[model samples]
Target: MNESRVVGQVRIVGAGLLGASIGLRLRAAGVDVIVDDSSPSNLNLAIDYGAGRAARDTDDPALIVVAVPPDVTAAVVATELTAYPDALVTDVASVKVAPLAELRAAGADTLRYIGSHPLAGRERGGAISARADLFIGRPWVVTPHDDIPTAQISIIEDLVLDLGAVPVIMSAEQHDSSVALVSHVPQVVSTLLAKQLLRSTEAAISLAGQGLRDTTRIASSDPELWVQILGANSADVVPILRDFRDDLDGLLTALAAPAVPGARRAVAEVLADGNAGVARIPGKHGQDRRFSQIVVMVDDRAGELARLLTEIGGIGVNMEDLRLEHSPGAQVGLAEISVLPEVEDRLIADLEAGGWKIAGAWR
Candidate 1:
């Protein structure tokens, strides 16, 4: 079936971030959306935000998207599949294997159900934080079982494309393992690092900088939700965590005996491995392109940053990324602008000619 025909009427079972985001995007595209949530307040908030209308008995949904929490995903998917027998059902829950297993155990129609996860979300939850562009340019994994018809998989892929997300096909087990490493493990690490701050002195926090903030930012995520996610994927996550713990132990041993033979080399090897791992990540738009960064020192006063950006724009070089850093009590801010390697020389030369001080450039 075609995209529009496949997704004529979408019923979203949860009205949280993923649910509301899906509703918003579908509604914006002029598709009919019906939203329902266990929480009446959340349902109302999603409706108020123009995500979708309340469900009615007469409405026969062509598609059902389960956006509920991980703990309730299987139950909700089963319910939705039973309620809308003709509709193609899918889910946005982060974990896949457990929910699919639960559905199978519940005797739900697995043939019509496709498991999917849009690898897009904010640290914050709820409809109030929903955005239409959340899934743009992100990987949306679709896990289809052996018994599922190819046509059913196509419908789900069409829906993913409708949200401007790229679809990656994987089995349930593959999806679970991939997210365990990329998403679940990072969240656990971030939370553990943030927990250390709770016991730290105010004087230590006063000296905190961007590195600390970046590492611990996701620690602000809802703990209860994470508990459910981690529990659901614990089988896949635990082994990775054990290996990570071994690495940490090695690092601690190195730190404890910095002057011991081979200890310093071990520490250096660990750091070098991190650099290699980071470099392996895909760059802008999932391409392998790496950009050169030029750091410009700007006055802390207002309008200075805007002036710098405007000057760079006038130089006819498109900046791929920008990061701003300011030291506490300092009168200057550092703006690191990333651009194509070929444009680095011209950009730096133009910026200097336009009376902007350049700190350095790195590839």
Candidate 2:
């Protein structure tokens, strides 16, 4: 069966979102999984959620996944390596170099361990927020050092594949620097921008739209946890933040006298640069091709979204992406569907013919 394709048993430590998600997916594949957490309640909650069973004394695992906070990841990995001498161990910490360095310093069996980071997560934490498909179609980086054997690396890749995530092999340093630019710095920027709302009047907030919501969606993440993550990866993050600061300073100067010579051009240059940078971000299925977006208005009621999806499937158009936005007090929600540019006109015509209100289409 499918269960025999992966490791026979997986022991998950730290029953947070990542750990519990791994457990849930593994259990679905019919693999034996046991979960543990520093918090008894968290462990019980994860088990209750059907992530996995409680750890038992006689349980032997072929693989162990450490899913703790960045600060304590090294200690836990070292401890796990010592305790389960026969098991392969990996961690899902955002920062990789620090933990690897710490583990090496502690004389842990580095050969039996590899560090990994799944470039996927919601703004929320905890097992209650976990989902079995959390890593599906997401990039999961497998950080391997020179000491690790090529054959042994497959152990982690097999798990990543089983969880439906794409495995990317790289050194720990490269992973740390890459995530600093993409993940860590973005978190800092979002949190700081969201903090500005504290002084905004209710009237000012009322005018907010999808742009504000999209940019600051991750600001809802826990502060204490982010502090641990940012601090752990500050070495790579600080340089990026400094560059951002320089850009902000230049923009502030240009805004100080917008009518001055070259001021408007400077602002335009900044915006154009942003357009070029964002376009570099890969689209659906890791392709760089941009899709045409069609905004369809739907009434805010049950079965409306499902009906739309069902109709789209019947139309035989492959949707590349979908996003929903609701006006603050409006009874209608906007469904932004992204499709291939070539099919945009036909799909829009068919959708309108089917009595769907077409808000707009960007071809």
Candidate 3:
């Protein structure tokens, strides 16, 4: 948290993952955070965890954050605006366009409200999985509304910065469209792909590895929550999904005729296009750069991976990414650590010298 942007008080509605995480971070930064929830047990749990104390009628929050589900986001924001007349209200909902539209239709105090969506989360939910640093280095979108002044949005921007997130200003429409492609559609794709595994045999599923895990990990997310998100943004999400269906049809046709003329070329073109798409995605620190991976073999026991990481830290090499893979019947696991290309050879040299077995290294 930054001292200059130190807020006197923040009242967060909905003690779920986002709200509790915000409270945890703000409370740790010496800010007065009041966390409230419809479920008293959930509220008390967050309070007991020191995310924030129970709300008091005398509390005058400088800012209010509504972290409820997407379906009720607009209603909650409207209620917050009416209750906290002097406070600015923002939300952590996934969809922006519908909520803002609903607020306008209801004739709420629009000038004091802004819509926010932080592009960060895990497959899990609830306050138990919340962490103070969850939003660190993540993008938090602030939607532009006609009622709010350009200067008034700065308060929300400061709140984002104080949470260690990068503030990305976008219009409500742009935010909805962008997230449809990047987040909502991906959830649908992952869930549908994971559904295919339900019919697999034990032996077939035993052969699954990192690739399948990577592609379908988000399938574990709460379906109840995702239904609301996807439905709210379906206007933007459906068209992209239709495009994907067309591409898949072409791919399936090519795979069905691998020996036919031009079929192999069609398949190769699809794969090459996929490679290009991946290369366009930003890497570490949200920059377009390459990373080199160094896989180290570790005994599947306590402290082995810890020792490996401690030694990497001791060498002052920043790990851009990491992935762990362990087979059920194997005694050793592969720790794939990604670092800058420039440090690849030096890292392998240092690790091998330190008695660490190198499984592989590549860019």
Candidate 4:
């Protein structure tokens, strides 16, 4: 199917972050969207935010997207499949295997259903936080059953592309296992790390740095929602947790016996392994490209950062990534700009010639 052609109407079952985001993007693309939610306020908010309109009884959508909580995903999907018999159905729940299993056990129309998960979200939730570009440059995994028609799978893939997401096809088991390692385990670790701060002194928290903030940022996610997600995928998560526990035990043993023959080597190996693992993560949009970074010092005064950015634009060098860091009490901030390795030396020279203070550059 052509991507630019009209997709007709898309009915969304939930008005939360992912549903509203899909609505917003599809509406922006001139597709008719009807949004329904159990919460009246959320549906109204999504409508007011230009996501979509209220559903009508006579409306027959070509596609139905179920974005409700993981716990109720199976019920909602089953109901929608029965209600919209002609429309192809897909759900954006994080856990894939459990819901599909539930639908199979219930003897639902599994042939008309596909499972999908968009790897994009904010620390917050609800329609108010929805954006049309939420799924841009992100991977959207499509898990199609063996009995599903190829044409139906293509429709879902086209919908994913229309929402500005790259579609990656995988089986339900593979999808569940992958997210268990990458997404679920990280959330569990972050929440556990943040829990330690509950018993810390106020003075100690006041001394916390960006490292602490970065590590615990996702800990602010809704606990109830995570409880459901973690529970649904517990079978996959438990094995990963066991492996993690073993690594933690090894680290503790090394720390306790610092004087032992191989204790120092064990600690060093752990840190080195972490560095390698981080490097293995693909860059934006699963691109394997690596970038060189240049750090420029800018004053804290107004327009300084803007002036730096303007100067970089004038240099005709494209920046791949950017990070800003400010000292605790310093009047200066550091802006780290990432660019192609071949352009790093020339960019630094041009910036220096343009009177910008260069802090450092690294590959």
Candidate 1 lDDT over residue span 1-363, tens digit each: 124434578999999999999999888888899999999999999999999999998999989999989998999899888888899999999999999999989989999899999988999999999998899889999999968889999999989988988899999999999999999999999999999998999999988877887898888999999999999999999999999999999999999999999999999999999999888877766777788999999999989999999988988989788988887898998999999999999999998998889999999
TM-score of the candidate numbered 1?
A: 0.94
Report how far residue 241 has shifted in candidate 3, in Å: 0.4
Lowest lDDT block of 10, candidate 1: 1-10
lDDT of each: 0.91, 0.92, 0.92, 0.92
Flag regions of model 2 displaced more than 4 Å: 1-4
- State the TM-score for model 4: 0.95
Candidates 1 and 4 compared by TM-score, better number: 4
Look at candidate 1 and give me any clashing residue pairs. Answer: none
lDDT of 2 at 57: 94
Worst 10 residues of 2 by lDDT: 1-10
Candidate 1 vs candidate 2: the lDDT winner is 2
RMSD of each: 2.4, 1.2, 1.1, 1.9
Is 1 or 2 the stronger prediction by TM-score? 2
- Over the stretch 1-363, how does candidate 4's per-residue lDDT look in tens digits? 124443678999999999999999888888889999999999999999999999999999999999999999999999999998998999999999999999999999999899999988999999999999999989999999878889999999988999889999999999999999989999999999999999999889878766787799899998999999999999999999999999999999999999999999999999999988988888867888788989999999999999999888999988888888785777998899989899999999999998888999887
